[model samples]
Target: MANIAPPVEDIAPDALLDASSSLLSEHPDKDRLFEQLAISADRAAVAGAADTAVGLAALAVQVLEEIGGEPARLGTALAALGRLEYERGNPDLEPLERAADLCDDLDEPVVSATAYAYLGAALVALDRPGDALAAVSWSLAEQERVLRVQPELRPTLKPVRAEADRARGLACRALGRAPEAMDYLARAVEAALPRTPAQRLKIAEAATLLVEDLLAEERPEEAMPYAEIAITALGDGFAVKAALGRQRLIRCHLMAGGLAAAHPLIEALIEEARAVPGDLTFRAVLADSLAQSAELLPLLAEDGGERAAERGRESVAIYDELLAAGVEAEGVHTGRAAAALALAYALELCGKHADAVAPLREAVDTLERYAPGNEQLTGYLARALLMLGDALVESGQAMEAAEVLRRATELEPVTTPPR
Candidate 1:
């Protein structure tokens, strides 16, 4: 009898990896070792130890490759590793491509379908939408063939089907087939409907994509429900994702001209950001979002200027903290500049042009320091200079305003095309 490994849930991720490594060194049943490693990797991923999961999955593939394991086993290991890598935001197409090639030579329809599905997803992430479409087409066809032969596996393949559909939707969108993308994304959402708690994340992902599509098309009413669905599905456990969902929901309301509806959501997002123990990137994102809300709200509501000023101050404070912390990333500097610009705009909206001059000067100085010679930032620098000139004029600094305006006009034209 083959040696079966103990349950992964019974051990810590680090301990399981250590044990798996020790077992590999002993040369005990190679196939069984591969299975144990694969199981451990999946369990680690489920437990949110993404790095450990990728390590285990990579080890599994290495073990199989070293011993010249069967193509089916090797393909499975490669596919698992590729999937984990993609989830970890460091996608590489090599493993997934190799897994798909191996599947082509095997008779295991389910494994072939699963491998292709993962390949399609990775291709989408890598921005090869045309290739992604072909891969997902093969995956869906293979899945259909399996269902024809063994309908009983339908329940097991729901998540796989949803994954394939979502990949197809993203591929179509990238290919500029808007209507087709919407249909596929809607199907993906339906296919991902939760049958268990574990399935909720899938549903949230699909719904989020669909909402983005709808929002892009200016169909905010259609986007609202899916945005809400994504937020509800994420619940409290996935704070970052839930906050993103709220941001999307807020956009839906704002686009539909419901400033009142968006207000509470914006506040909720601020509260969530403050409550969550997130890293610098999350804080930067929250600050940017607040600045954007502050800039937009004043355009939508009569009483919004005061609220915008409040949020703008908060955004500027966060950016100031980030800068004081010695974060030197270009994005951090740009975000701080943008926060200052937004605060100035809010202050001007509140009829405080004199007060706005200070922030406008800060924005102009920041951009002048960081944006020159960078094509992408040229327009931003010019805009900041122009705004600063106007603020100076309003604050009765006519001579300074003339020089600032002349400098703004001397900037090279921003000719870079949008992506």
Candidate 2:
């Protein structure tokens, strides 16, 4: 909903009020007055005077309820209010539902379809994807009906239909129907072209979602173009969106075996993450990401031990800071374990077998405490145990090494392909 643009209008508040006051003073027809109020409210919303828009929309609804005006016209005013709330990123679905009902009562296909589209969008925000999908499907059916019966309404209905398509795509993605989602989102992006900056932001956001779905399906090559499009569409003004796009691109490069490309991209992302204000979480996460990525760094320019140790220490420092800042310990348990494991590996790489023992033990203890009996974490836990056993044996702790190796053997053994 943050992607939606308000009604396109540019009217001065005082002048608009004065003109509306003078016109109302002449006792205009009730229905016409409702239309006038609706127009003013929409303009106010577009001009960023949300309070004024709400007041005017409320007045229009009051006139309709009291004077028995056209139901379709009343629905139009209600739907406008819904659009205002949606553009503000917190849509209230009740009014949109009411508007849809009112339009249905009037047999107004077009307005009802638009109302359903907004309702679906609100439902998507609420995380009710199944219900949202149903609403959007209804909206699309109505749109098709209207287009077939009243071709002249195309100019007015095209954008609303596009909105419904986008909503459907979002709902489908939420339901794990990625291929269908990609298709609908692609259509929506095409339809939303030549829009204002605010509206184009929505297209960029949709493209980003498509990219995510593609990447999740392990189709990095297929996701690259959409990631590029999203990055370009985010422009320079929205730093968060641009950063997210860059991160996705970096992941794509790494997954596609473009390690040299990913190296500089990862560095750039780390720099940007450090510059983000108000939260240290992004920096902590990026530090961890860099530590993992650096494992792929070569030993020609720098020894594997030194490179891994550098990243491992950087990650540990950030993790400690995050903990000191009151970040929940449970939330970072996996990260802490991973950092310790990396440090232990780096020590082993440098032939400091005894020095690696403490970190390996710590990693094993952390994982055992937090993730006991969890199959998904079994592989990681087993690796830590194996490393600890190896370090213990090398340090002449034969009994401890035997015990650790026994535990490691009890857990599942995992295989890694040669790098």
Candidate 2's residue-wise lDDT over 1-419, tens digit each? 11223211233543545444543445336666666677777667655566667667766776687677677877887887786677566678878999988877777888889899989888988899899988888888888899899999988888888788888888888888877888988778667642434455677889888778777677888778788888887675667767778877876776676777777777777777777735665766566665654455532235568777777778777777777788866747677777878778887888889998987888898888876676546677888899999999999999999999999998776642111
Give the whole-model CA lDDT for all candidates, comma-separated. 0.79, 0.74
lDDT of 1 by residue, 1-419 (tens): 12444544456666867776566677457776677778888777776677888888988898899899999888888888887887776888889889889989888778888888878988888899999999999999999999999999998888788878888988898898989988887887766744333346656887888888787677999999889888887764676777778878887887787877776677667666777545775687678778877876776564447878887888889888888888778877877777787788888877888898888888878888888678657777787788888888898999999999999889987642211
Alpha-carbon deviation at 97 in model 1, angstroms = 4.0
Worst 10-residue lDDT window for candidate 2 reads 1-10
lDDT of 1 at 415: 48
Give me the runs in candidate 2 sitting further than 4 Å from their true place. 1-73, 105-108, 124-134, 149-159, 169-258, 299-303, 329-331, 372-376, 394-399, 415-419
Question: How does residue 81 of candidate 1 score in lDDT?
Answer: 89
Task: Give lDDT: candidate 2, residue 233.
Answer: 72
